[model samples]
Target: MSQPDNPLYKTETASYRERWIGFIHGLQDRICAALEDLDGQALFRTDEWEREHGGGGKTRVLSGGRVFEKGGVNSSVVWGKVTDTMRTQLKIDGKNWFACGLSLVIHPVNPYVPTTHGNWRYFELYDDSGNVSDRWMGGGADLTPYYLFREDARHFHRSFKDAMDAFDTGWYPKYKQWCDEYFANKHRGNEMRGIGGVFYDHLRPADSADADRLFSFQQANGNAFLPAYLPIVEKRAVMPYGERELEWQEIRRGRYVEFNLIHDRGTLFGLKTNGRTESILMSLPPRARWEYDYQPEEGSPEAVLLDACQHPKDWVK
Candidate 1:
């Protein structure tokens, strides 16, 4: 809910930003590479966009792939004088800020392969003299299944919990709960967006040594993305699905759309900051549906997914 409070080591502020930009861009490439390899038939289209203010980002979108229907891997390195809206939202008195991050969303073609999303970001606020007064890191990964798969959910949750437990034994459970709460669609009966994963923020460094520790933690989570989601996708991508399954997927995607537009802070931030609208909305599915009085039959797989959402599980346990 809150942001990070650690200050960037000031001795090499420019160098740090450079390194972060390099890492994020590199992450974007590596993830795209993996997706391209997995997809085989489709390739990602890259768009390098410049912000109106002072920075730019590379957006890579893959569609109609062998496995995935649509996916986006994007990285942005931007900085500017904090706007009044940002000042109000972030509640910061700082004059300027810098942000760099990589975000990704993968929607597999088959309903068997659950949709997945993850992001990792670094941010800083600075004074007039260009000294970093505050800095932080935030992100997490989660899975949304049209057909609930217990093993898949457990593996996804366990993978992130391992990444967090390596840093703090308490972080896994704490942030696992945070994710469930944070990604909910409150207007839709408090249903979760997905099977929960560890979500953390305001990871402030207590000392200089702690900064490196947090960075490594972020890298660990980011690197673990493939392992967490790929196996499930590989198993399910080629499984046969009929129109009924596809219909449920689209219906579930309606809820995904609802959560993003109605509650996602990322969408709000991007729109408010005048960030590229296309790239921000690339998270949406290629197709979705909303039907009046739609209801899944009891004891059906679709109903099972809804039941899971209604009553979240402790996947790792």
Candidate 2:
């Protein structure tokens, strides 16, 4: 969206940009620390990189852990001139564009511990004079469990729902539906990537005060991630699993890879906009397999997981 013709757009201050950047950087530190503590045997290695066209980012990855198999927590602040590709693909108009966000994906060693993804971001479209013509905020967190744990699904959804209810009770349901729809393999009969969590985007604030409110909302969701996920990890990480479970987990991870590579807007957006290849694709699992015409036996645990993926259920009333 563009509003270069509107004189009022120039009056808006961009102070929130710095505040958001600060919040995400701090969040990266906290999350990395917590994950390291959880693994107790692995540490995240940091890679600070600069974008050739404009801004850069910090990428931290952990692998070969006691708990986690592979994980990446990344924060990026990037800016560049609006290009024809952006106009044609992203469908937004601006002389310059700025975006800052934090995105993460965690894959545990145990198949029982669900893989999770979370993102919180802000975008600004600047006019020819560097005035803010349009701005908005977006992002959410979701769960992708290899094995269906109804209680874990409820816990993940309720944690985010509680965070959203503090602002607007309506948000959790709306975003939950969005998450279900957004993270699906439409080509594969609309099967969901996971049970689902909360997702929202294109949140444009009405005023400076409203901007502050949205910032708090984003922060609430960001803060909710640990509590939403870590307890479930604690409960499941030590559960006994065999070759059968591991095989199913890898099979399911194939679908996760399919969604991210094919249908994920964030991944496509990053690659199209000259974003770092490694950071953008870090959401993929360390291992995956696509077995042709795979099917689980009737009334089995794998069948249960497949049923949930095909038909989403309300995790919280």
Candidate 3:
């Protein structure tokens, strides 16, 4: 990755660049504030760091709270020369690149409250002459619950569906299915990480006009995060739990870890490209457990979640 050659950047590209950077940064602040209020007991500690090769990022983490056990909301802006491996992964050839994105993950104290992950990003590739060679925008949100709740799942999906429907009526189904396909543990007989929300990437604009429209669509979905997730967190966070429930949460978190470490592209991209280890792995839960092929008792809540993960449901229809 390489720094943005400002002198060669087109005027329009610079505007969108500033727009996305401001948007993600603003979202980080807003989400952190809302989560702090929801917890009512803890504040996120901030760590501002600079990437040794290029740009820097701000990582804010909250831990050991009344509601949220651990969580992170991070925003980063980085640019540098592209490498051969990156070219192979991205399937593009360029000497330089610029990327900006916001990534977040939240794990709650109550097993009933589902864990969630969401990210939005923009990428641009530049040729040796510093001219923009390609650009795309991508993002989505999804849910993972230890104890399946039909209504909570419905609420979360509905919030995002409504957001996308406002932009394109057909996008909900397409993106929803895409989400199910993208976040899966295929090695484990195609089990999913969560109930599914919307996931999309490489959303290149069809025309210059669509660029702003896509940006607005990104805003709509990004803004939808709080309503989609916080309401469920509010309802479930206060629910009572015990050692058994906590144990189950950790066991399920084990799956979350496997997916992120072995299957997640973001984690891979970050690690391969020299991204900060702490910020990237912040998506992992504070606690996790793995047993020797541990199986939940028949009809147990844990089994129910696994069932949903194996056979994803249509939450909205």
Candidate 4:
């Protein structure tokens, strides 16, 4: 999986931050193109808006695709004063701040394959005198599949593992476990979303060595997306599906909605801070249904799959 040479890498005078933004922009464009091509139907609606306080973002949403029911790829470069409530939550001393980042969520149409969400962001704080006070980087990717695809799960996990291994052998298992734990629905006795994907946040630059290591890790994971996902989508998109599968998918989507709305910190932060409503809610499935205590028949493959979603596996092994 050789990526096309990134032009941003060749720029000599651009600051690291500038280069990062350029890279993100290019990546977003490429992803949107790939998705549109694969879907064979143009479903994306590009949206632009200004923040009430200062800056804004571009939100690209695709819905009613042949493969994906709905998905959103959005980027925001926003800066504003941090309220006292925010300071309390982040546990930082800051009156004003600047934050910018790219985030995306892809929800596929097929019930067999999983849904995925990821975001990478940079945040900085400035003193009243305009001097840099504190800064840190945050973000990670996670996978949520409705029905299990063993090889697809293996491939997804392996790609992420390779990325983490480049930084540290311990990183893959550690962060993978963190992802499993983080996305759990505690109200439902800690039922997990999917098997797992690497997740980390609140990373700050240490010495040069540590800073470089963190940057490398971010790059590796960011680059891992296509290999982790595209093949799985290709394999499953054309597979025959029945009404039962669709029904099960909708039921599981209900759980997905519950987790995002009730438990996800990212969703909470976005809504609390006046983030774009459509963009924030774009992580939801295109269609979903909830039936009281609905249970698939015992010993059925569908039931087995639902059991697997509730209990993860060692897919790489």
Candidate 5:
């Protein structure tokens, strides 16, 4: 597919913060629509009030479909007094917060392809005097393919890396490594979630001069999502496969479930912060299988992919 001539870029406006919110909402709509069109499944969204936190969010979920195994696209705009733990983690004093963001995950039914995730957020902290104190940006996109596809992996990585390199060459390799390390299953001796994708958090403007640069970087990464992922999905979604491959996919999905439930910081943060329960847990796959001490036979294609997951590749040279 040819790249769109009119790329989405961040613009400096008097209402920059509002524009960010609008951008996230627009992206959420676009991604959900694309997935629905490709997969022939409609997302079921729940508009529920968070009784625990006195806020509300819309959680869109799709499962048991022809194309998607399961997927969720959700957005929450919550406000309350920051907890002690949050203050310490954010390194800010006691205050109230106005936080808003969009989070999503897509799990395709096919084993040959990859599951993907992307999230972007804007936050605001207000001091006792109700003056804005600490504000920052965070979030990223990642890929998790059950079966290895080297060219697809390279394409995905190169798309994102080129986007980052346009802003700063230092970003792609650094964030790519960070993505690999961040999604690792430490208990399993650092087995990665998938081939690496860009991840970053808690980014702030270094100084007056750096603000525009940082915004540019974030925008570029955000706009790269379609190019980085959709092509891979389209290429692999139709590859013929047998029941053995499907079973193996479920087995691998079990590992994905383990990582998200046990080790994902996003999961923990959402759960701990009184975020929406269903939306937070929607990252889990629809079906997964766990076997006691399961190991693929040596020299099998499945085993080869597992070995590669254990040791990630340099997808972009």
Candidate 6:
């Protein structure tokens, strides 16, 4: 696919904060619509909820589909007084804070089709007089396939690389390395969560013009998600799978659950800030299994996946 253009750059009259909020909400709608069309048999059920402290969000989920077994595309805009918890856990030194973002995870029923995840968020910290003190942007898209498909992994990584290269030629390499490192089960010998794509955090802009550019960059990545993933889903969603593939998928999902609960800062931040319990944990797969001393046979497809996890590949290059 071609590199995505940043049409969202400098096109809005709204303030930077408002522009991000509007973009995430609109993105949620667009993504849900496209996913429904892809699933063919399932629809998203939305829950519009408010946080007791400050802002609210819309959580849309789809379950029991012909394609996807369970998935969630959530948008949240939450703000409140910077509490002791925030200071201690998130290391913010502001009196007040505001945050908005869209986070999503799709778990396909067919093991041949990889599960995908993407998130794009913006945050601000305010001082005593309610002036913006500090702010930054964070997010990226990654793929987690139970079975290795070289072309599918390459397509997934290349699409996001194209998006980042439009912004900066250096970013794809930097963020791709960060993703391989960040989404790993460190306790399990640094095994990656998937054949990594791209990940970044704490992208502080130097000025307003730079901030607009960053916002546009974020939009570029967000817009790239469907293109990166949908084609792979379409290609593999029809492939046959049996009990063996299903078993391996669940076993790998168990590691996915491990990374989120134990190592993910997003999960830790949400819980520490009193974010919604249900929405915070929506990234978990519908089913997972842990078997003691379980290992795939030598030279098997499952073993190939395990090997890739242990040694992250430069898929795009």
lDDT of 6 by residue, 1-317 (tens): 01121111222322777889999999999999999999999999999998887778999999999999999999998877778987887788877677899999999999999988899999887767656788899999899999999999999999999999998999999999999999999999999989888999999999989998999999999999998999999999999989999999999999999999999988998898889989999999999999998999999999999999999999976
Cα lDDT for residue 48, candidate 6: 94
- Off by more than 4 A, model 4: 1-14
- Minimum summed lDDT over a 10-residue window in model 6 is located at 1-10
lDDT at position 151, candidate 2: 90
- Tens digit per residue, CA lDDT, model 3, 208-295: 7998999999999999999999999988878888999999889889888989998898898888778999999999998899999888
TM-score computed on alpha carbons, candidate 2: 0.96
* The best candidate in terms of lDDT: 2
* Residue 30 lDDT (model 4): 73
Clashes of each: 2, 0, 7, 1, 0, 0
Model 5, position 101, has a per-residue lDDT of 73
Output the TM-score of candidate 3: 0.96
The digit string of per-residue lDDT tens for model 5 on 65-152 reads: 7777788888776666678877666455646665567888888878888889887776666667656566677778888887787898
List of clashing residue pairs for candidate 1: 3-202, 4-202
Clashing pairs in 5: none
Q: Lowest-lDDT window of 10 residues in candidate 1? A: 1-10
Q: What is the C-alpha RMSD of each candidate to the true structure, in Å?
A: 4.0, 3.5, 1.7, 6.1, 7.0, 6.2
Q: Go through the candidates in order and give each one's C-alpha lDDT.
A: 0.85, 0.92, 0.89, 0.76, 0.76, 0.90
Q: How accurate locally is residue 52 in candidate 5, as Cα lDDT from 0 to 100?
A: 53
How close to the true structure is residue 86 of candidate 3, measured as C-alpha lDDT? 81
RMSD (Cα, Å) of model 4: 6.1
Clash count, predicted structure 6: 0
lDDT of 2 by residue, 22-86 (tens): 99999999999999999999999999998887778999999999999999999998877789998
Show model 1 residue runs off by greater than 4 Å.
1-12
Q: Candidate 1, residue 34: CA error in Å? A: 1.0
Put down candidate 4 lDDT per residue, 1-317, tens digits, no spaces: 01112212222312555756666677678778887888897568989877775567889999988888888888776666778767777566655565667788888887776788877776666666555567677777877776676787889989989988877899788888788888888998788766677777778877657755776777778778877888888888887888988888888788889999999877887776778898889888878998998888998876777677678677789
